[model samples]
Target: MWSNLPFDLLANIFSFLSPDSLACAKSSCRHWHQCARCLATPESPRRHPPWFVALPNRSRGLFCCAYNPIDDSSSSSWYMLPLDFLPIPTRPVSATAGLILLRSTSTTPFQLAICNPFTRQFRHLPTLNVTRINPAVGVIELDPGHQFGELNFRAYVAGGMSEAPGGGALDEPKVEMYDSRCDTWKVIGSMPVEFAVRLTVWTPSESVYSNGILYWMTSARAYSVMGFEIATNSWRELSVPVADRLEFAALVQRNGKLTLLGGKCGGDACIWELGEGDVWRMIEKVPFELGMRFLGGKGCWDGTKCVGNNGIVCLYKDLGSGMLVWREVADEGRWEWFWIDGCCSIRGQQPQNFQIKGLLLHPNLAHSSLLNA
Candidate 1:
């Protein structure tokens, strides 16, 4: 039966299967495995790799951790990636375009790291001349369409330092750009608003890159979003409709538009899509009962719109069950809840190693199989 199907057609069919399914298909028969491998290659027209989320396990005093959700039911496993290799006090701030950005929490000079789990290749970014005293770092791919070889991939680090007690500037915040191509760093510009030391004072939220500019949200005890042009190195503040102060929010790309997921203080979640002229319009809001209570005010916006892989948006939830669960946004504004059992522990303790720290879906690995086949 397999012999009758054209090779190209079979390869295309395998592309839609999940990573686990792709592995099973390979074991089904030599022909199927070969086709499956070919379809998984980065060069393949229909390639989708497994997605990963980083969750810190402060229990062991280790600032680094993550979890990878496997589709396999029988043997669900989560792996651990430690930051012991890097300097101390490093925490993951963002993941974009196949790279994870980890920043140091130490007051001593620190550096940022752009790591690729699949390749196990990491580039330690040079320290910015600008000091980041409690700053937020935002990362994004400069050109998603351009291959790593064709265009330079960059991550934009932004945020300001806490202010002094006497109503004076304690630390000036600045934005810096890291160029993967040159293996160098450059200061772009400083943040427009002066930041106060108060924890209640919202510093810059996560920044999202779109159309050569990066956007971030500034509460300022008032509500507003700002845009920074990487090329021109200029800052522009924009107004966003005032909403309840969210403890955790993220900037994500959906269908090529920049979207915001705001988690309010009361465990409510709302989705805002960037409309014409970069206006933010609220699209969907999670009802209070939809396991939103677990969000604990933190969520990651993955550019997925499907049930299985892409368009998966996760909000951290602390279910009364005493376990850390994730509320997954499903198709048509539906919500599904899944528990990461034995996955989380409080500071200074390590949870069971069932969770995966970092996961890389290499479409390129699929291509290697095609060559051998």
Candidate 2:
């Protein structure tokens, strides 16, 4: 059978395998290993359950934990990634299409780098045009129509605290983008000065890209969402559901749709999908018993944070209590939950004072043009 099929066709079939399975197949023999190398590029993107990455709060070392969604057994379900080979101290700000955008807190002007933790590939990027504190940042893959050989992407930084000439007033915020192809940064678009301040103060810098729009959960509670349409270079805001009553919430794009996962303190955690007319349609909810177990007598859900993309959404305690994940089964037309204990894999390596949070991304081990420089 192996001799009957073409080599390129075998590589294309290998691209359909899960990363873990593909790894096993690669190690089975030498010929398949070559096929696995061809799986590196985003040109033939593979499908794998988006895993939740638990990053230690402080960038003490270059080690972080990865949560495997497919593993349901009791064995170690996390991978402690040793990124010691990469130079400089930095933390991941955004991850898309297997590349992580890391920001260096040690430097002024906020140095950024693109690295693939899977392959130990690292490259430092040019400085952002604007120096901002808690800026809303995003890394989006610019569509190359699958025609170009090189991977093209854009990094965005919008709405953050910037220096002003006088101490008396607020400075207008600017939106800047970095092009991987050109290896340069340029101002793109911006929001209102007041709006940018609010986003900087309340919202996390992580942005979710869906279709042509980018969304960030704005405000302390699940009050509203700020959206930026890249095609139009415009900004828009939409109110979330049950803004006043919900104790916790997060805006995420899952299964290629903008969805919100949130819940009240004593109620079940719920999922809502945004449908036509900008309305939220109720989808699923965690059972009462499961919700209580997730809370674990915490007494409040305010510390919950949500991060997910594509076909998965993960809810975890900000204090590193544990993680509750819901993954969509496309063929089944249903969703399932997996609860991973937070204290399992990276316990001894972290101190009691440290906290951890997970960001969902499909890690690509392929070569990126961002590394060309």
Candidate 3:
């Protein structure tokens, strides 16, 4: 009976399906696959905002949950990621264009794997030659037309302790990259002498890719943002204002602009946009009332985070307070907040590894079988 329906009606019905459900529907039959392709087409109007995926807490196996508040408000409604094809004891360091960069837990030489959680497909890259405890990781998906199913992307891993197997600390900062097209890894660049001196105690964090540059925040003598131009393979550094205060700040991209989230001296969280000449201009602050909701009208916030997808920005108070997602009401000058009750309740059993972070991925009908390992 379903097969007798018109193609338009079938496409319309499938439009409402979530990423996982849509993947399953595509495999149900030939007609359904055709309908799924319509939604996956580059010009389809059924594109949905990326879902926020959180890493599992303590379980031995690698587990993840996808939270799409727009489709379901309840935390329990989030879907589990199909990571059966990926490596175990692995942690995701970066996510971009529907792909995740995962590193195995093996000691010394760390192997890398890139996977698309939505499609349940993954490709293993060669192991990184580093002996550092933590390294900054980043990825750039070169899908100009937003064709997510196509596995065309590059991954970068940089900066870690150069301690060799014999326990001698080399402390040499290195950068290596993997290109999916070439299926090979190459040494792109190394840390500048002047920059390495200041990075004696570097903190391994995830790098943010915006435009063609990848930015990583380093915590050493002072806070600094290190940038690497993927196309040119050049490097530069920008000092973060009053680095101590923004110690745990998160770097995120908003509509192609670089934004930083940090707490004020008084403890209120504020959002700043990167401006020309290495200057940062304050754009938004957590209203007093909103801060009071999380602060209990007493002390300052512990710390806050900002994550964005498309134009939507999610201000998260990692200290148990619920998330506040907002977007400029198209053409309206004011921003609006999306309240997802019980959103913060779903914490990972174990926190993500030091170098791994959560990612916001847009919904797509791309499947894993189509991509090569």
Candidate 4:
């Protein structure tokens, strides 16, 4: 009878399972697989809140150390998810929804793959049409189609320089796009040369995808955001607030809205919601004591990390400092901030050993066709 349970009841039961347990259930029987797959549409509610995953490159096999903000400093819990199943040395290029986009380090021109580490389901995408380093990577995961009912997404590499025709300098600025449904890449178009140079040289691969637009913060002196609209294959830029005064800045999609987080040198950290007409309005700011503590002894937010989605945003300052987690409650129109313990589980020989990347992801239990092997 348990196996023959009604579809509604079974889906309710499936919703209670954690991601790992859900994976086991999907593999246990054909009936369960069918049951689980039916419940995996984009409309399904996620089981857990967003978690901060501090991904550090490791040689003795890959392990994911994640921090759940709700656990509080007293518990200081960290979840370790092994990534040994993946066959290559790869860097996480971008993360959206339940999928992580990875770039392989083993190949001449880096290879790209999108995977759900929780389910151990992975798929490698075709080689990119553009060859460049450190380009702005973006991803947009859409709701399943009415016909196929399969979840789909797009992975984009924008504003990267290409080797010159004469093979002189890495000068051509172009955008490459990959569609998960087709598993292919296309050279979308060339980027404005100014943005391409900035992107190819050093923009953070972490990006914000919202409303079919992908956003990346530039490293230029006047810090502007490079945005790409997938539908039109068009490029645009948004200038950040107090660009010169701020020592730290990042773009985040908070609760389906565009947000800006930054702190000035020897000043308070701010959270701004991007308003219509390309304006920014303040939503919150760090409490003075908290901002000072987060800035560490250097007394500035230099090299800080701001990442989140779906109403949760996290801020991290280096030098072994803990993270500041912010949450917005929609029904109440309220917001709160708190501090959680840092990633102490990741061990290394000082800071010289590895590249540590961070992203805020809501751990999902349901099946994603995009990640299904």
Per-structure clash totals for the candidates: 24, 2, 5, 1
Q: After superposition, how far is residue 121 of candidate 3 from its true place, in Å?
A: 3.3
Residue pairs in collision within model 2: 98-364, 255-310
User: Model 4: per-residue lDDT, tens digit, 291-364?
Assistant: 76666656778878777776788887542457787877546777788777665543332222234577766553
Q: How well is each residue in 1-373 modelled by candidate 1, as lDDT tens digits? A: 2354455446755876789888898899988878786763334332232444443422133323333343312223334455444444455555555455666555444466555543344455666776555555556555553332222367666665544568655555566777765766787776655532321146433456666677666666555666777778777766655444665455655555676766555445677887887688997776555433343323422211111113444443321112222333434455444544434443445544432233222212122111111
Q: Write one digit per residue (lDDT tens) for candidate 3, span 85-176.
A: 65466776666656666776654565777677666676667666554545667777776454456567788776655666687765556778
Off by over 4 Å in 4: 1-42, 57-60, 69-76, 144-151, 318-320, 345-355, 364-373
Highest TM-score against the true fold, candidate: 2
Candidate 2 structure quality by residue, lDDT tens digits, 272-334: 888888899988887666677788865467778778877777788653466677877757978
Judged by TM-score relative to the true structure, which candidate is superior, 2 or 4? 2
Give the distance in Å from residue 11's predicted Cα in candidate 3 to where it truly belongs: 5.6
The predicted structure with the larger TM-score, 1 or 2, is: 2
Residue 231 CA error for candidate 3 (Å)?
A: 4.3
lDDT of each: 0.50, 0.70, 0.63, 0.70
* Candidate 4, poorest ten consecutive residues by summed lDDT: 346-355
